[model samples]
Target: MWKLERCPPHTGHQYLYHGSEEEELHVSRQVGAWLRLQGDASISRKHASLKVSHSAQAVKRSICGSIELKELGAKNGTFVKHSNSQNSAESEAREAPVFTEEHRLSSGTEVVLRHGDVVRFGLYDYCYRLVRCELLVATSMLPRSDTVMRDLLLLGGSYSKEWTQNCTLLVMETIKLSAKVACALACGRSVVRPDYLTQLCTAVKQKQQQLPATRDYLPTITEASIQPDPSLFDPNHDRKSVLSGKLFLLSSPKLLKRVQCIVEFAGGKCEVVAARHHSMIEAGDAVILRTPDDANLPSQSPMAAACKVVKRAGLHVVRESDVVLAVLYCSTERFCNPALSQQVLVSTISQSQMQQQNTGIIYAPETQAISNSPASVLSSRSNKTTRTTSAIIPETPGSTGPSSTLIKSPFTPAATATIARA
Candidate 1:
């Protein structure tokens, strides 16, 4: 299994669909995606295709292991974006009077894409990655005659730490800059440089310090949540410490105040009342409290009737154990450390960085996150210019076989270690 992860999920500005097919799976738009690129005026009806096929090997291979992005003949053709390894060549190259002449990607050609192969179009670029490379490659033109393909297909390769760090840093920096640009524009700061992307890479290398390796797993603190300290019942605690997200407690009077204090201590806006304060539950709760078991559902009413009452209210009922999970998922702004989340993201990107690790790839058929598999692929070309670039697989061997590209970190040995540890 291999995947193409969209760093910042929203690829375009607007969205639309006929009312009839709104709920269909793989619902495609008239614009902006593998489903179609109709959002921009510079695009044509059928620019290119993102195809999955059996490797164009001399022999048959069991695993249907190749991806082809073939051009459909149009103005302003496709290009493959290379990393900073060739900055000088890139600057001079794109500035050439014509784009596709030096390296031509003619229509209907198959590019056996590797991980992090950035495919460029008229207005946007997308990165594709091949996972489980050993098996996929074994079946391709790259002869299984060697141990390289044999080991990958049989024994998994130990991911290169240095390569992982560099690629992770590059992806992270892009994600960060994209966010920064968005924030700047939101603050009415119109000026921004796309080149800041590379600078971000440099800065991350400078500021990052080595951290001790640790397990990466979601925390299970919900079940063991601490009761509010007795002193919290103290009338003197600062009210400003209330958390940002709202929490509404709709349960027994005995559990109300203690729960409210606990939630508030974590900075949530808690709403609770004594049992005598209400009859039926209130309507405004974004998240409503429910007991861990049916024992607390009101001894007076039958379980079915109580469930009916809850179902009518449009409330997301969560147990006590879910409190912490909810806060982190919804509003991790105040309580949780931002550093932890960064570490998690960096680690995932590092492990799956296309240039290094190509094993354990899975096709996620989702618009926002990898899910099943994309049921629809959309592409459009420009009607105006005939431009294209040779598909570049960075640092790949000999005569430009598209299956694999192993990239090295640009950081010094000292910085590479620290970045990897971080």
Candidate 2:
């Protein structure tokens, strides 16, 4: 009886991540990686040979969504076959599967493994193996293989006009390049398709080009004053503070409500109004933002307006702040794509706050006053508890605990916010 070596061609009936033997297979031949099946099965193929291995506990992930697979050095090199035969060489090399969501390994047949190749199992443990064969080259370069492939894909013309206009491809490709290959490939064929890769490349390129050109001027938020509409504000002719200036809140409607509640509870009254058109804000104002759960929203929604506000007002309101207690309620599961979640996490990372320091437009937890207001007490709690209300005219509800309220001191520097609505 020939014992399974458990080495090189380590044929196993089970997977570390999926925990099964009969798994689905999708290979990106270009990058020499495979995508894990969605069901409970593990798959292994040998390059240049006719044997394939299977198990029952394999995991599954998506192309552009959650779950990913990466390859480790294995005796059998994973291959991704394409639909078109005319450009087989070009397609084979370019479509060489790494852990990318652009292309899946459907339709194409799995090839036998040889030396210097790799195979990835599933998402949980993200297990992978490298078949020790003479063909194995330096494994160090594989870590950055995605980057080189992206550059190559961009230069090779594998995207479309819609992808460029919409900026989907580039973003997706950027993520693929950033992710570990072993984890990417385990996601399986659903995430290893051709159209997906092309789209990702296009979107990423567009975003890279749209970066702000100058730090001095940002786009206007809401310059057109609604002061004429008495319904918009109170008619306090002499009373200076009345939601008079504008602020841009670049947050989701849900989060906006929560923050507003916190402010009101803390005795600070501010209006959650629509952003203005091309309006610039004064320093010492607040800009609140809720990181977009969907990657497409930031590019499609009021994000452009917020960017304009930031450029002109010299302010950027981040999500995590200590001066103005920002509460975070995001979970990794809410996002469809892990890459998109990562981007949100990066944008929302917590930052330290300085006491009584005011930073303009982008609300740094400083207590600087952007506008001048006469002294007036804002009563939040009816009892002995003290509530700090903002001088801004619009009033909101009151607070319950230390974690809910953000108090702005009177001595802080003055700033104004400018908002715009699309």
Highest-scoring model, TM-score: 1
The lDDT values for all models are: 0.30, 0.26
Give the per-residue Cα lDDT of candidate 2 at 178.
12
Q: What would the per-residue lDDT of candidate 1 be over residues 1-422, giving only the tens digit for each residue?
A: 22333324333211111112112112122454334544554454666655443322311232323345566663566655433222222233454322222233576665655433455554444322222222111111112233332222222212121111111111110111111111121222222122222232233223222221111111111111122122211122232233344545545454343244335544564454343222343343334454333344665544334344445553223434233322322333322222224345335334433233222111111211321222121212322222211111222123222112111111112212222332
- Candidate 2 structure quality by residue, lDDT tens digits, 355-401: 22232222111212322332233332222323222322111123121
Sequence-dependent TM-score of model 2: 0.19
lDDT, candidate 2, at 386: 30
Q: Candidate 2: lDDT over CA atoms?
A: 0.26
TM-score of each: 0.22, 0.19
Error of 1 at 338 (Å): 43
Give per-model CA RMSD: 28.3, 22.8
